[model samples]
Target: MNSDCVFCSLLRDEGAADWIWRGQGASALLPLEDGRLAPGHTLVIADQHAVGVQDVSPAALTQVILLVQQVSVALRDAFGARGVNVLNASGPDSDQSVDHLHFHVVPRWAADGLDTWPGGRSGHRLGTQWPAELRRAVTARQL
Candidate 1:
């Protein structure tokens, strides 16, 4: 574990907030923030330290996402949230505040005033011109 990472410290020390769940590959808990960003705002983090998605094994990432799904359901039931927003900031240029990989599961409701995505925008863009080999490489690879 990285001695400098707060998440690592939280896990290793064991005096952190109440854990929602914990298992072989992932753990869930309320974020250690000044206050909840939204009702039932929780974090699902990989048990092993990894800076981003690319840094983790597929099995580990799968475990984390599965836990996120479970926690989202729990939030929906416990908080009566209409829906939830599963967010991850995976890289240096991303809005990730912590180095360790984690996903924010924020409960949402109508007019929650939480603009997780940019508002006042009509549409978004996707790159049509792309590297054909990128698709080929992924599809051709064996597990």
Candidate 2:
């Protein structure tokens, strides 16, 4: 675990965390941030410190994803959520705030007023046939 990571400290210091579930690979909890966007805005964090999802091993990533699924269900039921959103930011360009790998499991309702879009959102809307370039790139990259 990285000593500089807040999630690592929370893992080491149980009293500082409010857990939905803690396990070998990951833990789910309410975020420590102030003025949460929505009720039951939970964070599913990796137990081992990894800067981004790409840095995590498949096994550990699987564990985190499973826990995210479990937590999403719980939060949905608990909060009577009409819908759910599971979000992640992987790299600096993606605007990942923390260095540790984590996903936001947000319980949502209609007109909840939570803005999930990143800052400086583009005004351009994707026309149906316009994304053919994206498809071509995916094919060229063999992704």
Candidate 3:
């Protein structure tokens, strides 16, 4: 494990984390005191060193998604959560605290009272408008 990487340090026991489950190539756990959002809310992280989703392979991405699904189901069942939010911040612009690729499985209850980002347009709509053919081509390439 690299000492410079916080996730790696956590995996190596150099840093402390409230670990829940660990498999061969990943770990699922709650964050420490300063990082936790709510009780039983957790993060599912890739075991190998990956800076972002762009660095993860298709197989690894599949594994991570499956693990996140498992955690979501377990959290909902165990804690009676109304729902769960599976989120990931890919790059620095998206409020990424750590560089490592990880997914947050946060359990949401009616009483928790978290608010989502506002969904209103600004001066103009952002992003390029592509034809269906071009969109299909891009999706195919992503696969």
Alpha-carbon TM-score of each model against the true structure: 0.83, 0.78, 0.82
Q: For candidate 2, what is the TM-score?
A: 0.78
For candidate 3, the per-residue lDDT at 77 reads 88
Whole-model lDDT per candidate: 0.84, 0.85, 0.81
Candidate 3, residues 1-143, lDDT tens digits: the string is: 55688888888877677788887677897877677677777999988878778788778787888888888888888989878877788887768888888998888899787754547745754456557767788789776
Which candidate should be chosen as best, given TM-score against the real structure?
A: 1
For model 2, residues 12-126, the per-residue Cα lDDT tens digits are: 9835777878798999878877935687889999998999987988788999999988888887778788788889999887778898999998888989887776678667798
Q: Candidate 1, residue 110: CA error in Å?
A: 1.3
Q: lDDT tens digits, residues 32-139, model 1?
A: 677467868998998899998879889999999999999888887887887998888998977789999899999999998888875576466657745676787778
Candidate 1 lDDT score relative to the true structure: 0.84
Candidates in order: C-alpha RMSD to true structure: 3.3, 4.1, 2.7
* Candidate 3 residue spans exceeding 4 A from truth: 118-137, 140-142
lDDT of 3: 0.81
Which sections of candidate 1 miss by over 4 Å? 119-128, 131-134, 140-143
Runs of candidate 2 exceeding 4 Å displacement:
33-35, 118-143
